[model samples]
Target: MDCIAMYIDGQWVESDSGNVTDIVNPANGRVIAQATRGTAADVDNAVAAAKRAFAPGSAWRTLTADDRAALMVKAADLIEARAEKLAVAETNSMGRVYRETRYDDVYAASGAFRYYASLVHELQGKASAENGDMMTVTVREPLGVCAVIAPWNYSMGTTAAGMAPALAAGNPVVVKPSSLAPVATAMMFEALAEAGFPAGSVNLVLGSGGEVGSALAAHPDVAKITFTGGTETGRDIIGRSATSVKRYSMELGGKSPFIMFDDADLDVAVDRLMFGIFLSQGQVCIAGSRLLVQQGVAERVLDMLKERVPKIRIGMPLDPDTEFGPMVSKRHMERVLDYIRLGVEEGARILIGGHRIAEGAFGEGYFVEPTVLVDCTQDMRVVQEEIFGPVLTVQTFADEEEAIRLANGTRYGLAGGVFTSDLGRALRVCSGVNTGIMWANAYLEDTAGMAVSPHRQSGMSVDGGLDGLLEYTVLKQINLKMTPAKSGWFAGME
Candidate 1:
């Protein structure tokens, strides 16, 4: 049993309290490995190291932008070399299908680092003339020490999402990965170290949110907190960081809606609709949990989904042919099942697979069959709340206006998509829907240069593009006076 230890000041060390947490393989609920459980004291050590590494005149802070870019590129290269190992670790630890973890998670993480590496050179300030006698110039400076909290669903991706930008901006980061899936994150720390990052420049502290996460949020030395998790937890971090008035960026929960109009190509709609909800077992924050279809085509679409969704392969994550894997844990699976029960009690009709699938083949793993609920109203809990599972609720609308109303009915506004061949209808629906991210004919297509914004209660943060990189920095204005002060204005008072 190899137990992973905390990485601080560029060294692997045991927890100060000697506490440990077990890592379970979601494929079969096996306790595969152990990880040291960090505490407040451990957080303090890592944060102190980050602060020191980010202090003025430190090697990390004094490096030129191009120098930092080169280091980031090197880190990216290291990640590419270890891609296969990282993919296996991620899949084994978190139950993500290898088909996805191998390509999307691993390479996407590497791409994030490389994207920021390229963007580091473009981190330029602005200058403007304030009349002829004075000039105002603005420059972006790195925030001192940043605490980056990663979510379990896409542990490596979210970790890279937060850490890459912070590093590119010359800010040292203290990362606290989710306890449920910290193995790949630890491996990433190893790769970064081998890539020659300065000691203490990038640190990792592994533990539960109540202990390590809270301490990181409230630490006085931390200048910013970047978090990706549930809405309630995001609220807690925001409140905790308020004590120090520390800047924060968060990508939280979403109950995104996928609208299919009568004009949509039925073939494309069916495929995208299924993948939009079922991909990653619907653990994604941007999962299209709500499916709003126009009344004219509702029955046809539901018929296609009902026939296709149940056929999705459900088995171990490592199986090359497995299209869907088990839920992350027994507790999460039960939570989703409970939501299904609630939906039934509220009078929604179950259209497809629903219930736990554990008998001869499941081997006590956390598995839930793909579920669909029809005859759902906008007010139903199943439609408005985030199930965070491979459960889709079908709701029909009479027209475009009704569809827009249904899509915007929820409290969340993270993401939504509109499917229609009519460009005018697509544009209209996309504009009327009140979500941070909107797609006319696609869903969850991401690149480093595009910004991911969450609206309303979904979250408050910047997660992509130049704005994402700029979130790790502070802006300062420099005003120079080229002319002497006017003494005549005060002559009367003198």
Candidate 2:
């Protein structure tokens, strides 16, 4: 196995504390690489580097928006050039399918950098004359050193999604990828340096969340923190950041609901459902894990899905026809299997694939078959919690209002869908559902348009589209001299 070094400041360095961990591929369970475990000391070095970059007269501080954008564009180009290598690295290191790395992950990751490149020019400064003789104008500046903790579900996408825009906005960042998938983040940062980001402007810190992540959040110099992970982890980060009163953004766990109404198109619902939870092995933050089908169409859809879900070809990540890949790790697989057990205990009928009792196709690596549970209820544990696996719970809702209520009832409001032929009902349901992203007549499709929002306990505001790029910015209102009028009150009093 290869030794994966940690990236800090502007160069690769061994962790100060000198702890190393072996990274296992969830696909067939092999130690693909090892990474240096980081501590507070390592986090400090990165933060200091970023702080220096953010300091006045530093290269990062003086760079023009276009200049930064150009550099990011270069980074994107380099990523594309190195696509095959990075894709394999990501798949082996993080257990994502190799094809996904080559296609969806790479596209999203590289496109984000390019997208934000052009967005640099869109940062508008506002002017207001009411403040004083000087007209006030707000300039959106970087939030300083951002401490980001990405989740295992999306090692590359989460990192690139948050990091690109944050960097494009001129914020020097310190990113901590999920220890589960640190190698992928390391690869991205390595490519970033190769792509020519200024030294200290972008840094990666690795280790456990307890050591590196929490420390970054609590770091005095770190200004803002953006994390994508479990909901409980998000809550803890929020609590930690509260002490320093630092700006924080979190894209926490989501138990997204997929609803297919009686009047909806079956083919559309099935297609959307396939992409919703099954895509990425159902390891998406917004995976439609809780599939809510209206009573009128529940049986038919379930039968269709039962036939469809199993037919999905699963194999090696690099295989061209591989439809499903392995989970991130064996530990995650165990968790998923346990949740499935819990689902059964809660009286939900397992429609397909449950036991991880060690059988054919199941080897050392953590691999569980994509499972579907029918006859589920909102009160059930499987329906409520985030399983974060290929298992989906199917529930039947009575009417539109009930569907809305059930969808909103969960603690998560990250994403949900309502499929209906009736456009009017779709619009109403979209408005009523407490989700950040809602779909009418589809699910998890059109994500390009549906900017990822961190709704309710799902965490904070969005991190996609105009809102996403804007999150990295802190506004400062400026007052310009409109007429150079004297202060009447102060002059009269004097």
Candidate 3:
């Protein structure tokens, strides 16, 4: 309730220069509260705190795997107990439907914390094939100080995606939550500390992405940087990491395609398509921005979507009756509007809502009516670029090959889905799509099951499964020579 302050090194501290940024309610252009604006100096302090906590002599370094897991479980419990309040703040800030904040986001964060917590003791090493008396082995070691940069759309969920794994791997973290939704993240950290984490183990800072964010990415002490945001921002961060050659993992921007084949269940596919893009007012990274529908089913699916996308109630997140909320900010909402305009100008047909939803009985808020554009082309900016709003651009495909071509046309490979009754087609499309993850018969859904990125844009690692835990650690190889033999050291011994 109080104006939120940043948490750093087990203490709540305001910005060193007394800078502050107002947290606005996107539903209406109203300043909900003001948080202390973080700066480069703040990043320095947080990074230093993480460094010390990850140092060889620090208390955090000596904790047992069970001890770390215990803390994660405790933090999740605390968040669960306060789910109502946390859900309200998160929904208000990010414009998720109440059911989502109350169930999807909060539950996922809780499950992730527990999932990574369960992985603490699972960091097992392997013994390699040995020759004679010589032996070799590989073990995973902590990456030391980790800097996590989270996005505004799913502030808590994305924060958990990076932080939980790092903490589970025994690495200390310096967290930079998106300034747009700092209050909820600060609250989450407060819960983390309350669960008895050591001092300097977790820290939070708030500010514009370009300022404190760049400092976090480029800091010499930060051993790893995990980021989730726009692709250009990810590119910039990767470039910045060159200064220190730090290890980095990115869940960058996605323009995931939602493909529906002629054989798919029209009712189910249409429902998921509506939910996939319009759930958080279409402000999700994997929003299924490019909806690829087979030619035959296109008209039927479009009819169903036309009714579904608009019927979703657009109002205050706090209202129990409201099903959808506003976008994060007026600027973001305006940009989405501009994109809708561009889509029309580019010859994409407007099938459903495309303009801003004017003030209703509740009055002022940045609400855009759920917009759908059909007759989309692959080269169109609306299909190729990420439109992280509750807007859908539909494209018709002639067959499975055309669908695959249209789906893989975008540069993004974060996520996509295939809706079909034929198992062969489902398997074929799933295998053919150039994406980190592909779901059959579902869209915009996530599970603890992980996927490996075959391509580079989605990154070189995986999350959600056992492979996900590797992002927080490094692989080291050790060799032993029981024979005390040298490999022709003096050109004599062989």
Candidate 4:
């Protein structure tokens, strides 16, 4: 098996601890690669390199915005050229379908770099005259040594989303990808290095969250931290960053609602319903796990789900024909299974699947049936909490008010969807929900120009678009005295 190394100071190197963790293929339980497990010492070295790179007169810090953007464009091109390799690595490590990794993940990663490159000039700050005697010019400057902790599910894409903006803002970055699926992200570092970023400008460290992630969050030299993970972990990162008082952008967990009205096109609603929850086996942070259907059309929606869901192919991630794949790991599979079992114990009816596939060719892999539960209440744990798996809990709402109530009932406010042909009703629900991102007649669709700002405990700060690019920058005001003579206010004392 190939061993993935950490990229620090523009070179691929092993961990300081010299320890390695096996990277398993969730499809067949085979060890496909090994990632060097990073430690606090390794994180310190990476951060030190980043700090040096971001120093006032260093090569990285001295580059103009256009120069950095040009490098990002080259990186984007390289990423596109290496799409197949990256897609395969991602599928092997994380168990997402081949088509998704190839078409969705790879493009999303390259697109982020390209989009941020185009907006690098937007980091400009305004200048204004405060009285004729004094003028204040505000300029945006890079925050030193940004630390990005990317999660396992959408590893490469999410890492690029954070890193591209930070780099475009002229901040050197040290990224720690989740150890469970670090291979593709390590591969992406090759493109960054070849794009001619200054040494130490882009670095990668692979390990568990407890060590490498914690080190990055708490490192005094790291000026900012961008994290995408669970809510509990986000809280921990906040505490770790408190000592340094570092800036943080967190994209955390969600139990987003998919509201389907009685007048919604059943065909469209059913298709989007599946896409909203079952995409990536429902491992998405913005997965619409709560299905809130209007009472008039509840049975029809359930019937359509019953007819369509079983046909969803559960096969190896590498298979082109496979529509769905296994969980990211055995442990995660168990967690999902526990939630399914709990849903049953909570008196919810399993309308479709609720069992793990442990027989036949799937015996060695971590496979669970795509599950849908009906007769569920809003207060149940399975409905209220984020399962982070291929499970959807169904609830019926009597009217528009109830639909809005169910949508905002959860503590999370990340993303949600509203399916209604009624323009007025859609707008009302869109406004009523507490989520950061809401879609009408669409689900799981994203563009490079839009920002996703998590609300409540879902997370803090912004990700994507021009706003996200600015998150890596700090504002400084330069005041100039227009007059040749000093102010008369202090001259009276003299």
Top TM-score model = 4
- TM-score of each prediction: 0.97, 0.95, 0.95, 0.98
Candidate 3 residue 382 Cα shift, in angstroms, is 1.1
lDDT, candidate 1, 138-178, per-residue tens: 89989889898998899888899889999999999999999
Poorest lDDT segment (10 consecutive residues) of candidate 1: 485-494
lDDT of 2 by residue, 426-480 (tens): 8998899888888787676665523666678888866787778888898887656
Q: List the candidate 4 regions with Cα displacement exceeding 4 Å.
A: 489-494
lDDT for model 3 comes to: 0.84
* lDDT against the true structure, each candidate: 0.89, 0.83, 0.84, 0.92
Top candidate when judged by lDDT against the true structure: 4
Task: Give the lDDT of residue 318 in candidate 3.
Answer: 76
Cα shift from native, residue 258, model 4 (Å): 0.5
Q: lDDT tens string, model 4, 387-451?
A: 99999999999999999999999999999999999999999999999999999999988765988
Worst 10 residues of 4 by lDDT: 485-494
- Tens digits of per-residue lDDT, candidate 3, 1-494, equal 35678788899998877778888888777888888888999999998888888878788888989999999999999888878888888877766778878887777777778989988877888886558776888888999888889988888888988889999999999888888887778888988989989888999888888999999988889998888888789888888778887887788778888999998988898888878888788888777778898889888888888777767877778777787778888889899989999998999888888888775743487888888898888788998888898778888989999899988897789889999999999999999999888889987666565645524465545666678788788989899777775567576555
Count clashes in each candidate, considering only residues at least 3 apart in sequence or on different chains.
0, 9, 4, 0
Q: State model 4's lDDT.
A: 0.92
For model 2, what is the error of residue 388's alpha carbon versus the real structure, in angstroms, after optimal superposition? 0.5
